[model samples]
Target: MATATGKNAKKTNKQTDTAGTKSSQKDGGSYQAKDIEVLEGLEAVRRRPAMYIGTTDARGLHHLLWEIVDNSVDEFLAGETDRINCTLHKDGSSITVSDNGRGIPVDKHPKTKKSALELILTTLHAGGKFSDKNYARSGGLHGVGSSVVNALSTEMIATVRRDGHEWMQSYKRGQPTAGVKQVRRIRGHGTTIFFRPDDSIFRRTKFNPETIRQHLEDISFIHGGLKIFFHDETKGETHELHHPEGIGAYLEKITTDGQKKSVHEIPFSTEKDDRGNRIEVVLHWTEATDEEVRSYVNGIRTHAGGTHESGLRTGVAKAVKNYMDVHDIKAKGVTVTNDDIREGIVTIISVFLGDPMFQGQTKEKLNNPELSGQVEGLIRPGWKRGSTPTRRLPTRSSAGSCSPPALAWPA
Candidate 1:
């Protein structure tokens, strides 16, 4: 091995081989454990929180809540958990979520040799979602949620009650203060995540109760009857949202009030196969003015309205047009363009499968191009199956009718 000085090449003395000895072969030098590399700590996140989280403002503050909620959603997807309890402190700077789902696995990760929980919290992009076999459905497709939240929070505490024991861990600015340690022995399984956004990183730590309420409310409606409780510890306020009728009840809640109904609500759904792929589709036709279609893959909202959304739109529009043509009903003067047809139209599209590709860090869209055809093909032909058209009156429905739909799915 040779050593050099940057200032000027300095010759290092080398011992000559003894008379009968042979020279050592050291061209590249020996590779050993000491030569192995390790990345620096989480200090980078403190320097650039925005790079990981989109912003350091109110959106970012809310992101902390989303990250935590994303975890609870994962539990909900797996049959391990159903209820998500969220509480906002009166101070408005903190929020906590408790889920009865199977808590994050506390076992060791084979690759990292660290507790899976710790690996998820400390390392970026580390979790079950990475392994196709382990996670069939995950909201946080790109596993940055926990680590990002840990990185941005001034303080975060995670409590895991599993396997007859209670384990707890805490972190500050991404560095774990203590490793995963048993806090106590418990009889059940679940997880509680409490976090306080760093004022240094966040311009404001205050949370919007309405935003949280709307978010949970939407999830409640989507999942339908998945008991979601919201409590404001600071204000002593508590509210619950759950729907038993599922999407049908969800549609009725949104479409029936004030003014005559112009377009009767119609639901089109069926199961179809695409290149050996199977998908189930649920769609509702409404004459409502705005085009409101929400797509979810395994409870994860595809807000971007990707192929799945496109497929539903294409399939439903084609099906409706075909239905009108078959009946020789000149909707000509009726003029139900896709936009017109969807105007004030509120529809929910959900696709459940073993494999789903969600685009981006937020998992807001279904990216699989095949998804469009899968979803569209499933509902296109089925549109006229058991289809009954209703007339829509040119009047607005009451708020009671518009009061967000209830969502209830059996636990």
Candidate 2:
């Protein structure tokens, strides 16, 4: 949170080396090529875990869980799976994620000459999601922490069911404990992974089932077609989250959970799916002084408002302007800016696109420049025509859904 100063902020001067290569001199100190230490494979992740997962705290520990679950969610995005299972063991420190989808490839990698499954677990930036050939849209952009998670975990076990056979592999702190072995012949396809976060790396080792369930529930609302089951052995409780109502249902839950009173009865929502790309938005005016906007890209929440959030606000503003223009309304000579239009706004936006640009490996912010415009384009028309001015404040809930030709406010 502090500004950079000192050595970290020092500018380097370029100098020619004995080999005619450029050498960097920081404040006239020796900074040669050999001074650079390269951390290979998952070593870098272990040395600087925060650089990959944001923190070595409880949140980052859960993030490791999200990394695995998100990969399964990617399979769902690819239309390869429908169900994802998350389990917390009695110890509350070990967990597992299972998905019924096309399993990770186990064949030898041409360049690395290692099994694809092993390569993906042991290396960084190695996975089927580098391009859209396997997944047109996925949430595991820079948070593809499979290798990072493996590096930070004290124990990890992977099981894959594909190619009409079952394969298994075990690892401890990113290194394989045994070679990948074919366990048995299997009929279906899917993947299962179990891991325990390293006590030395993470400040917190135990996990909260409530926290995990809330996340799974939120994810269910984002990807409405997918089913997520959370089993908390610690409490002997299981929760199933499958919200086909999508973001619309989520808006209601948000309002109720926060006890926020809404100026509108039924939230205005719109969703459009073109091939694999999809966008869903639900918004309402609230009595709250500040605005609340929950946004996501490919089902991963963007806590830091990004371009897409800006687009949602812009789109809302544009719609309000269009409505006033069509109705010949004015603000009594007062300069009613976009801020006025969104003063008490409550909104949720979810988008799934082929290629997403995130701010960092944490994937907490999306930086896709085109998303601002694309989201605005989609939302502008939907908003202008989605609602009509009511004579009175809206009351009584009407049918709310995110799927559509667009939505209208309750009369």
Candidate 3:
């Protein structure tokens, strides 16, 4: 009986030891440098293109166009280029964007010892947008737009006409297939990029002309005097987008839609704080109760309203409340609110600064706290000037009560 008990204990100890070894093997098999994976250069971008371009859907397809177009727009803002052309091939496989800006530097980079054009195309965060000397204000602030677009493209061709020569380079899936070679002697200065989206990375590869047209129109409206030409080889149609009046023209189109009646004959516009950081505002009110407020920071649209928008609202509200109080106007048992002042109003607020802080890569909103106070201070005077009446207020109304006078905005 004693020998049998000892044998049973030994069996239990063996089973426990075997179970512990299996558990250890499962938890800590091997930890070494080989276990870690490092993605170099544009490999990380190809592995996670969605993270850079937002998504792999139709919006991402459109974003590729915008990224390229924005580079041209930055050139326009820098006063280097006035004209840009975009063409969509009939086969729905390729698109080309050409701009009349100073062609990308063709000289070899000092650090990489590669052609500046090649360095700009192959490396991430390599561009003039990072330096204040090359660009005072730019839409492509991150400097990753072009390279990301190049990485996701299956085939890309870049052409530059500068230094009395036309240079050309080709790439396949972000790798240079050919060196920067001279195509021919040329007179003009500009850069052209032609690329085909990779089918494996995107769910759809076709280019949408209408969507591209709309985006170009918005960009043209935002930056007046920048001409954009869009040609669709598929439909043999061409469209030109140019707005000289800037956001004021955009507001005019919004007011003429026939759904709203304008309270002012012309929009009120003001430019202030012009020493370094500048704020520009254009605003008008309509009969409908819907509010349309568009804000931008350094040319990038802020769909998500930021502190700058908040400042505009606060300034307008304060100015309107002051006008109402001075005029002795009263709503029955109701306190005036910011919404009440903004009802049926259309406003465009644009800020130009040395450095802008955005929340994320997409730049949906502005995060600079100083802009809120600056915008408020800049726009309050404009609102006061627009709301102040030229004529004196009446002593009393027919019913022995005071009523508010009609509000008018300047042309």
Candidate 4:
């Protein structure tokens, strides 16, 4: 086709585009700043809960619960407290999470003039986790977890056991009903949040005991030192999940539950503190034909996977290769691949970082570019350390010639 070139082409296209825009605007009406809508208070979260909690279905309903629990867990991680108790009320729609940690401050906010507890429960992007002063590594980024829950909840009550006495405040749809009230004299410190998910927003407001129990179990596995108690008033039962054995025990439980036998008598696992971040991993070879990995960033599950998983896979492959080279083990006519090395391997990787970049408000994936390298660095060295006198990889030798040593369980 014949066409204009260079400067003439640019001029022609620009004129045509500008003229078309003017014509369209004249017909459709002009755009105006008035068209924009600024959602105030917690209305933005209420208007579109999915943007923050992923979905308005059953999962999102539980996300509201998770946000509060995670805040308490953050306290535990900060070495502020230990015990966390979660109660599902008989009404089925209400829940109460109590933690024996340094409670939310009840002092007047220097800027807002609102009580710290009230401000935290009523505002978005307002929390102590914004800096390392309160929490070294917290799952609460954007500082909206508690407030979002309050916004979505029909009623929320925040009880703080600080300032020498217990302070109680109530909120309705993210607005404080009244000023902080001083409850009867009480000792110690912590926070208790009671909330009911707004029925108008969620398809189902009833909290599933099984779903919550499973989640608590998984969290207990991750934070081995933290004690979690679940009181299911639905069944009048109380269950406690405390596994000081940590992820090592978690791996064993998962494999056992899956009916998969481990190739190693003892799985390879590591728990190391790098500065403020804690890196944890537990894994072993199995009889399965494929691999499965579960990764988490800052106590929040990363279901979509991310740089951490990439680092894990790379470090694992490198460790295998390094071990082969160090031992002078080789197969003359065979080739080893990363997939082969990882086959039938199931692993759980949990990392805690001071600042983690989440993919979205849902925090379903981790996006930090440096995290992968950090994870890999830890994994490689961890594998070497695990290869001590009592722990060794499988050795192989075939009659005709050595086949690529099928990575079996460690002996």
Instruction: Give the better candidate number (2 or 3) by lDDT.
Output: 2
Off by over 4 Å in 2: 1-35, 142-144, 273-277, 386-411
Model 1 residue 402 lDDT?
Answer: 20
Q: How does model 4 score by TM-score? A: 0.86
User: lDDT at 216 for candidate 2?
Assistant: 93
Ranked candidates (lDDT, high to low): 4, 2, 3, 1
Could you give candidate 1's per-residue lDDT for residues 1-411 as a string of tens digits? 975665434223222343213333343346567997655666666677776666788877787788788778777766678788999998899888999877888888887788988888888778777655765666676677888888888888989988999899998878889989998888888999888888888888899988888777767766664878999876798988776556655555555532224244345445555564445555444544556676777666676888888988887667656665666645323445565444555667766656677665666677788887777776666744553544332223232122111111111
- What are the per-model C-alpha RMSD values against the true structure? 10.8, 10.0, 4.5, 7.0
Candidate 3 lDDT over residue span 6-78, tens digit each: 8798998899899998987888757667899999889999999978888998888778877888888889888
Best by lDDT: 4
lDDT of each: 0.69, 0.82, 0.81, 0.84
The list of candidate 3 runs beyond 4 A from truth reads 1-32, 386-411
Scanning candidate 1 in windows of ten residues, the lowest lDDT window is 402-411
TM-score of each: 0.77, 0.85, 0.89, 0.86
Highest TM-score: give the candidate number. 3
